[model samples]
Target: MGLENVWVATLTDGLIRADYIAGIETHQTPALTGKPSRWLLDVTLTVSAGSGTKDSWEVSHLHRTLAQTDVYPAQAAEELARRLHRLRRDGAAGVLRTYVRYEELSFEFSYFDAGEAAE
Candidate 1:
């Protein structure tokens, strides 16, 4: 964990920011504040499970051109996929699945809604 180690999660209003930062060098630090409430899921998950259960996740979300192609609309991607299906029914989703493939020690984080699903 030493390639100038960086597994950062410094989001503001989208949660996950209680001074929680991994190895420094926060991508040229200049964010002086916080204001994010939605624009959910720019995710990329890949895990080809062997013992089964994860159902082999293969999600993708990347857009760096065409003005970011509407920047992930569609009701915030179905409300972040219904808050990731309520964190897979409150079992604490296995930290959002990842296999042994380390693409630069891949990192991304967010799941801030343990409410609004009581019906």
Candidate 2:
């Protein structure tokens, strides 16, 4: 595991970086000391326990990874967000839809809502 564990950068401090969301220009500057020169979503998929709300949706920045990473810190954060949501709704079956098929899904995920509207 010599080169495997070498962390070249820290993409995000938390699960979601609101600023670097799915739309409207994701974060340009990746934590860049450690891009694997490929698309392997650096961060491990840890679906944060919980779900959505009114003021906004507890959505993950996953969609962006498809392009951003290709153009993509964004790796893990994005993946984690998508995986969490699916797990919350679909369970292990969902996570398998993309990555890590049939891995014991963590029950940390619970609920989500659309958020209170504004006038």
Candidate 3:
């Protein structure tokens, strides 16, 4: 599937959520400063097939200002894709919540499958 479609499916299938996906707003807190610290990526996604039930999804710890040496949106996207791939391997239906954290220059992700509780 195309990148847009993949994102849509990932959200619709509960691999991710619409709310966790940031918008055009930028945040500049004390912890987050400097260039490349505040950025938002607008993506257009379409869900080709629906699961016929509401699927709960969440993504936290997407990015951190302390560790970023450059534009980190692309790296975050890649980490999300990697987590989604791992979630798909389970072959179960329901919500999949993914949490991503930075370990040095790499990203570590943990997933939670809520199963029928997602409904």
Candidate 4:
């Protein structure tokens, strides 16, 4: 079986934008153990500031073999939205960095700010 999901968000007149996707592939063999009937989760996140502009900067995360079950993709997407909301509420000042760590997997990303030197 194969499954894929995606999400996108735009806020503040396109100043902040994000894209997220999660997928699952079943019936795969493990490279290390050579075990069959293994499942794989692929997750990706792309966030941008000043989207479509010259000064825009983006951050992205990609993870393979994220989970044995397919449920994590949806949960992870929700978590990401929650975190982004919290950051906006707390005045993120442009999402300089972001990260997520759950169970045995972790994702980290950094955004490049063209305006950083001015501050």
Candidate 5:
């Protein structure tokens, strides 16, 4: 099995926007690392202020889904809060959306005929 994809989306006013597809790297086979490649859904926001041209605003959301590493929900939540706080400090008010998508897909099986094993 493999982690199919990673998706980032926009959300505002209690509404979900279209998803943004993030490029992902897949392993030909699952590894024994004990971590399932998946994204943990998390969102964060940050705000900041400065003088002159240095003044800027930024909004950020933590994306855990589609990750090559496995993460617990608590850890993911912590990351989201941390990132969001940073973003909130870095920028102004803006609706930032962070999400994950699980698609319903089917798979096929294959078989082959071969001679009996030798002792």
Candidate 6:
């Protein structure tokens, strides 16, 4: 399946909870104060989808500030990795009850129409 949606969740007690939608924006500035200007990455994770059941992990999404300091990049990467680990862990846990949380973020919508034909 294509990227219909994206979500990011934090895990606690073997359950992943929806955090917030991840928004990514980039800004650039010229030199200032005799120092070279640079680009800035602004990331805002908002809560889009409401709280879901333990099995609902598709409600969350993730993003990060790619142009920020090394720490931010590291943290972002680590957080994403950790979430994936949680997803896999659920299957391994082999628990009767499973819950996956998700954060809602803006997404690109795409679909195929019956009338539209490919070249």
RMSD vs true structure, all candidates: 17.8, 17.0, 12.8, 14.1, 19.3, 17.2
How would you encode candidate 1's per-residue C-alpha lDDT over 16-54 as one tens digit per residue? 211121212111123345832322223322222233347
Error of 3 at 63 (Å): 19
TM match of model 5 to true structure: 0.25
Model 5 has an lDDT value of 0.31
Q: List the residue pairs that clash in candidate 3.
A: none
Instruction: Flag the better candidate by lDDT, 4 or 5.
Output: 4
lDDT of 5 by residue, 34-84 (tens): 755542342322222234445775544432332322333334444444444
- Greater TM-score among 2 and 6 belongs to 6
Best by TM-score: 3
Write one digit per residue (lDDT tens) for candidate 2, span 42-96. 3322233345777665744243222224433334444546544444343221101
lDDT of 5 at 42: 29
Candidate 5: where are CA atoms >4 Å away?
1-74, 101-119
- Candidates in order, TM-scores: namely 0.20, 0.21, 0.30, 0.27, 0.25, 0.26
Residue 15 Cα positional deviation in candidate 2, in Å, after optimal superposition? 21
- In candidate 3, stretches whose alpha carbon ends up further than 4 angstroms from where it belongs are 1-37, 47-71, 92-119
| TM-score of decoy 6 | 0.26
In terms of lDDT, which candidate is stronger, 1 or 3?
3
Task: Please give the range of 10 consecutive residues that has the lowest summed lDDT in model 5.
Answer: 104-113
Clashing pairs in 4: none
| Candidate 6 per-residue C-alpha lDDT over 11-99 given as tens digits, one digit per residue, 9 for 90 to 100 | 22221222332444545556679776654444445544455678875554343332332122224434444443453443222111212
lDDT per residue (tens digit) for residues 1-119 in model 4? 11111112222122223323333222344446554343333334342223345677654454333344322334444555454455445443333222223422233323344543311
- Winner by TM-score between candidate 5 and candidate 2: 5
Model 6: lDDT of residue 95: 18
Q: Report lDDT per candidate.
A: 0.28, 0.32, 0.34, 0.34, 0.31, 0.34
* Number of backbone clashes in candidate 4: 0
